[model samples]
Target chain A: MGIIAAIDLGGTAIKGALFDGTGPLTKKNHPTEAKKGYGHVLQNIDQLIQRMADNKGIKVDEIRSVGVGVPAFMAEQGRRVVLAPNLGWSDVDFASDLAEQMQKPVFCNNDANLAALGEHWQGNGKDIENLLMVTIGTGIGSGLILNGELYQGKSGMAVEVGHMVIMAEGSHRCSCGRQGCVEALTAAPAIVREAKKLMDVPTDCLPDVNITEAKQVYQAAASGDKRALQVVEKAAYFLGVALANILNFYELDVIIIGGGVAQAGDILLNPLRRTVARETVFFQRRPTEILPGMLGNDAGVFGAARWAALGEAKKRG
Target chain B: MGIIAAIDLGGTAIKGALFDGTGPLTKKNHPTEAKKGYGHVLQNIDQLIQRMADNKGIKVDEIRSVGVGVPAFMAEQGRRVVLAPNLGWSDVDFASDLAEQMQKPVFCNNDANLAALGEHWQGNGKDIENLLMVTIGTGIGSGLILNGELYQGKSGMAVEVGHMVIMAEGSHRCSCGRQGCVEALTAAPAIVREAKKLMDVPTDCLPDVNITEAKQVYQAAASGDKRALQVVEKAAYFLGVALANILNFYELDVIIIGGGVAQAGDILLNPLRRTVARETVFFQRRPTEILPGMLGNDAGVFGAARWAALGEAKKRG
Candidate 1:
């Protein structure tokens, strides 16, 4: 069986991996360094794949296909990325361009969808037919797996959960030029912003709480910091509201909360679960299991590999 | 070919039809008269079906199968309805019970889902693979058609769009014991409540708005009633927000707004279209057509007949 080359292109890091049918053979990560320009990123990705192949005693050209996952709107059947602020791209054919650079057929999709796919293939949701995987990092991103397939709506813009407004008024503004989006209230920066709002009124917390990061807020909350706990509670509540909406809308089986913010563990999860239960329409039906992503960062790469394999099989057929 | 009996059981009326393969041969309606209890309701339904068959010069026993649609949470593969306050039933196996009364195999599902399926078959959707049919009547009910199949989630409780929270704070109370739900803010009664609240103020239109019913609100709005326009605007905005959330989540091709409330026409639809465009995540993608249903009340019966046909085929397979 031929090898599959997979890459998960992110704002800060580019995760690359090789799959040999059964499982991954080698995996590594490199700084995205997107500021260096598109050509630089492309050459770096090509080099990364070459090195991965060399390490596995195989030539880069021997790979069956290259699958790439990007954190952006993938449209026109993955021919181009509509917009990717991190990569400074808009209406550019990243997929086809990369295919040209590597001289091979390329398979591409949204990173969040790939993460859901990877999770479905071997992570927390292993082989489940219906799932919604949400990644909560600098911004919130999600992907849906429906009827055993990745559900990218008509324009390849399905599962955009972050933009769903929970609080219609008196809510934080989002990057999408909207207010009260789920992402604006719960992403890492929002978590830290909310914590800082209550930093003036100290209650069982550090006297000079220099909590500039979401991780620090989580740390403080874990240690019973009252203000930090409130911040986490608010974020978790909004996330749960959105989840409840999703659950009732599609009735998903599993909802995997991944990315940087989810590492808060039980503190973040407990409040989230409580809110979902309170907000859910199907209290009597089988409740969807809300879990943290098991594959972590490797989720996108695994999904990319699977996507490539499927694409290659389809081409052959 | 044997006849297929189809029924759309509503709160006040039972719509019964007999279909012979291609189209309905005879159709009729009878008052539900649910105040007489479950046994009376069941027997009445039997008579209604028998009359439909008799009008087509066929015996009741000659029917191949019966397909029924109810406005409630259908569960356990449509074996029983968990709750249908309209019919005053709880945990009742409507499918098997109807099967016994009709002396034939029966297929049962949510009325909204069947509406969607019917729309997909011959109504506004018309063979469209991906659609969301929302019926705004006494309560908001919705059913999804994805990839040309009716998408009923696990335990058959999917597309409960009305219960999703749109206004988190200081919103009206919903029947589900929640506040600010899409149903609470935009359903027929909600529209009337909102109009009544505005009636106290003087508008350029009605002297005594006395908008006792949702139909009157539409009529008022149609005549350019400023207060009524405000109510319609508010309802349209919330509905747009919910539809935007749905459009982003599933990426369906068309959205059919049926039931009695959608009769407001362009007054409701124009504002709804404008709001959807404003709130959509995929501004550049092919926009989902938000249109009124074409089949009117017949959408459910057509869907029920289609459901029976498919079910009967599956049984043989």
Candidate 2:
């Protein structure tokens, strides 16, 4: 009956958006200021949603629901955040806290899952029956939209595609304490690490831009550095293997690659697509296409708003 | 509203069962005689159903629906077999042919999915919201029962878990043209291959068995052959990795390990469980349990019968 408020609860920033039943009305980004403590983060989200609703000329209670996409492992249909290392949260009742803050029914889900939902609602994944949304940021994350719905497993932790190991011998170690995981090899940090490692070579191969972040690697590749391109290609190969493994099993309708590293465009995507095709079997039976996510930063908030609407309806029913 | 006939169309044998809505009435196994050609295989299925019906004092037309579980890649929601190398089937309209012969509605799915369905109907998977059943024999196969229903992806081919590579650097090659796949590293053939290589050692550590088959390896392990036990443990480790990967992502209620190799019981399961636990993360969040399949060979037929019951209803609607 009213507008829905959504928040993509990132570690450093919260991407907030307002949505009607149709599409996004407005979006705003605000600092999380997480060091101010848990209550402060909730107040930050509450303030963000309040500001979005204010911009839409709607009261907090007039908003249908407040939905949040947290960077955490959630359970209890996303009412709880089991662990969020960045936020230093463990087994917190996020939904209740947000609900109490806003005095509106709250809904929450994994940030990647919400991103997939966002794309399903307004981006490249619209009307796709089975879709996969892969987010390659500081850490690689993925979400499964199966049979036209988000497929959270029994514990609401399905589609851990980033952690799926593609190489057994590779030395890259993931934050999950595993080696050769997709996250270990393809995450933005991994790219930066690889660039850092390659820059130490006897021969000067890279275009120096003080390679502190993944963005510098893209910049180096933009300058047509062969070694930089090769680093990306190598990461793409491992990512391709992981994607193939996912596609071979999940057999989705399409996959949308999103997040910071994926923004490198054709350099990452062209090779990633080729690798997926090379590793996948029975392509003629069902061809699952790979594409870039269209929504950019707004995807998570859009997904969150949509989840609020759907979850609110489910609750009412 | 009549009795259902189910068939597990195996390469060498067809396991048939009669179900009266509630439980299995009787079961019969017959030679598939696949060498007799495709038509012969269909006829064998027809004759087996006819005999089973005659034994129950009913006409063929009395059956409500016939559901067959085939060991092949399926399309069109299991209406067609894309390929079955052992059965020499390729792009055949299996559902239509079976329906025409039996004079009843027909439903079909991958044999592995049917096994999972059977388990869901009457075994360890009963009432489970999400389940994964893995069959590891000639080649490893798997099925996902998600949200209390069989998850057949977009092309009716999901849960290709066996093809998920565990040891990327491993030398074993799978029939699907992939190296270090779960099938390559942990299938019965892989077990036998490992056993054979180790049997050639100077110490002669094997239990004096010919070791031409996976069963011999199990027998050797049973007779206190340390080499055979080690081979199984190694395979289990890879299987555990694959299982851990599946579990980490899918987060199912339970996992059922079935098929010829899985029958080795504690020797294989104990180590496999240990490995899964070791590789999996956030186990403290949701501890998924893995168990052995309870239905044995009857799982496929039971699953087929259940599919017939559900699919027949869906068709009517």
Return the top candidate by lDDT. Answer: 1
**Candidate 1's error at B304, in angstroms?**
2.3
Candidate 1 on B1-317: residue-level lDDT in tens? Answer: 36888999998999989988778898999999999998888898899988887787787778889999987888876667988978888889889888888788999988988988898988889968889999898898898998899887776774788988877654587898767789998999999998887777666667665677898888888998877888998899889888887777676789999988988888999999998888774433877899999988899999899888888888899
Listing candidates in order, what is each one's chain A TM-score? Answer: 0.95, 0.94
Cα DockQ of the candidate 1 complex: 0.55
Clash pairs of candidate 1?
none
TM-score for all models, in order of appearance: 0.93, 0.89
TM-score of 2: 0.89
Q: iRMSD (Å) of candidate 1? A: 2.0
DockQ of each: 0.55, 0.46
lDDT of 1 by residue, A1-317 (tens): 47889999988888999998788999977788899998888888888898898888998878878999898877865667988877887788888889999998899988988988899988998978889999999988888888888887666764678988877653677887656789988999998888888876555556667777899889888998887889999899889888888777676788898888988888999999898888874443877888999999889999899888877888889
| lDDT string, candidate 2, B1-317, tens digits | 46999999999999998999678887888999999998899899999999898888888777888989999988878888988888989989989987887777889999999999999999989999889999989988788988888988666764788888666656877788766788888888889889898766534445354677998888677767888888998888888877777776666779999998878988899898887777786533566788999999888998999998899788779
Identify the runs in model 2 with alpha carbons over 4 angstroms from their true place. A1-5, A17-28, A46-65, A168-171, A197-205, A311-317, B1-4, B17-28, B50-65, B102-105, B202-210, B283-285, B315-317
Per-residue error for B132 in candidate 2, Å, reads 2.0
* lDDT by residue (tens digit), candidate 2, A2-82: 688888999999888888877778888889998899999999888888788788787777787888899987887788898
Candidate 2 at A29: error in angstroms? 3.8
Q: Could you tell me the lDDT of residue B103 within candidate 1?
A: 85
